[model samples]
Target: MFSRLFDALQGGSGVGAAVRRRQVDAEVPNFAEADDVRAAFFSSALQHAKSSYDAERDGYVWGRTLRPSYALQLHPLNTVQTYTQKKEFVWVGLTAGPWFVGVVVLQFNYFAAFSVSLYNVESEESWRATSRVPLPGPWLGGQWVPNEKGEFGPTSAGHRVEFSAPLSTHRARLCFAGRSVQVDATGVVAQQLPNGKSAGAQRYEVHAVATLPEEFLGVVFPLGPRRAALVSKVAAAPLQSPLKLRLGGTEWSGDGYLSMDYTRGLLRRETRWHWASATAPAGYGFHLSEGAYDVDNKSVENTFYAGGRAVLLETRVEFHKVTAAAKVWTLTGDGIQLRFRHADAHDAALHVGVVKTDLYHAWGTFDGSIRVEGAMYKFDRVAGVLEDHYALW
Candidate 1:
């Protein structure tokens, strides 16, 4: 099956065959416009394209797919991310220097309901937003303004009758009003961003904290009364990301989330692997080799969407942390360092049904104070490393 799809993605050209085409708009980057929030225009565009992949296309066995970032599927979405800020001064330690925090509160369904906002923690004090950009499918949130109530309701038409937005290095100030929540985002955690010019692609620091008022806790997505029913499978708060890593005096935190998983499936198969070896201004360099694979054999895909960019790596990554390993059971490759110190290690585990599983996860946080990558580190109780021939999800 993988051989077939791999061959298809490699060269197969047909209506049903997967076709990879990256159409980067040739227009000059409007640094002046999208430069600030990176929006060349004041509008946050919604992008929509018709394809045979719709659910209506029906049954497929060897035909599974994955979606990375929702920002990529926006209708008339802005080619570049643009941020507009309304400042409310907030004091900082000053000793730590100025801090940057951005917030984007997305209001779906409502003419102006919610927005995903990014606020520079040290730069501003508070901001309120109302109203939305005139777009199709979902409403677009440009710059957040100060407001509580605008309009709330389901969309009239579109593939996604509901609304949801991504957040990175941003926070939210919201509370339920009667039935809807007000977008008064002020308590969101600070999001981190990658410097970009280095070896890997994603770089953002954000701590996600949600305040679900009593009324909203039972509520599900999709604004309509019939659709917004209580969810069946309840989980605990703070569902840590399945992946994150740190190395060589630098730390990399990852959260490859998929917002709209129709069937609530966790079978991730499609994704790519990246091997990055970068040197800082100082000669001290580091190597970052990471990627998502169907380690669990979910027959689905694992991916991430940051800054409105979608990155899909081929599933089944091979990691040879250790030079000599007899074989990799569930692990494609292994850490050459049989056992190391995970001094700053954190645990992110997932429990499914009657059995508990494990996932290959380890990382060290580096602050550029010393040689960190490959530096000897130890790990505590690990999580989610499923040992199977391929995948068992």
Candidate 2:
């Protein structure tokens, strides 16, 4: 039954063939709008109608097909118009000097939410602000805009994002303003996957750097899926960016790591997961994730990127909490083992009648080893994040 469902979700045809056929003489869209550029960059002809887990391969075969486009055109499997129950989001984070800044834009059926956070590595200080607004209809409408770049988020909502291109090297801008906090920043993709096509089981990813010129309070903050019931799609990229920031009228600059995350999908009533990633010296980066959405650990999102290539790992990862406060945790897998001690943390709880969410994100260091493709890489102290999230809707 699952195989049949997976086949159906892949359009019941050779996905590569179908995708190739659709690409014949297809010219990339020419648009001036940033949103339109993103839409074209992510757009795909495949429809994700169901979720499938491949036990033999220990991977989750995405129901959505990947093609050469600027935007993703994702459709829900069911006809129900419960927009609020559906979720889509784009999150970006960057580290500058002794500070880390993050931006998130989330859209549901009836409303949109935005968040901006800043963390100080030396003082272990963290601050976050969030807001939400009502959305009357589907966020982008359900149609593709030809020769134009679609827009994401409204200025009135206190957050907005724009992209320069869909594939290869690109640039993006994130702007936010609310109360005493205001930020405007730009991210330039220095390197990315050769093209916008999937390589075997790996998703598209990029490396970027962001810049912010102004200061907010004591910090110059610049930063930055599909599914059925519980369907999810995620793209993870490691970034090497240098940034200049101002805090309390003081200027600072340093090299830092950055990451971009985009997700869209229908969700189950309950969900939980453990996810972690980090960038190290010598162009080495790693990503690890495990949980309910991982489909029995078969669809592991674990990979190591080195020397401009990515190596996907087949392993089991476990997360052990050393304390209830979650200030310390242990992560172990077939070829990886690491310990994390939280340096800074953020927690949020939201309840809107039938829907509820709890999130904990910790920034810290990992001390251990990661074996990629039989080569063991060691880390004495590598800065990164550990996140635990749960939702009930």
Model 2: lDDT of residue 65: 25
Q: How high is the lDDT of residue 21 in model 1?
A: 47
* lDDT (tens digit, per residue) of candidate 1 on 74-150: 11112121111101111000000111112223321112122222222233222212223333212233222211221
lDDT of 2 by residue, 61-106 (tens): 3322221111222232222323434455656666545666665655
Among the numbered candidates, top lDDT falls to 2
Deviation from native of the Cα of residue 20 in model 1, angstroms: 34
Stretches of model 2 off by over 4 angstroms after superposition: 1-70, 76-82, 134-241
Model 1 per-residue lDDT at 134: 30
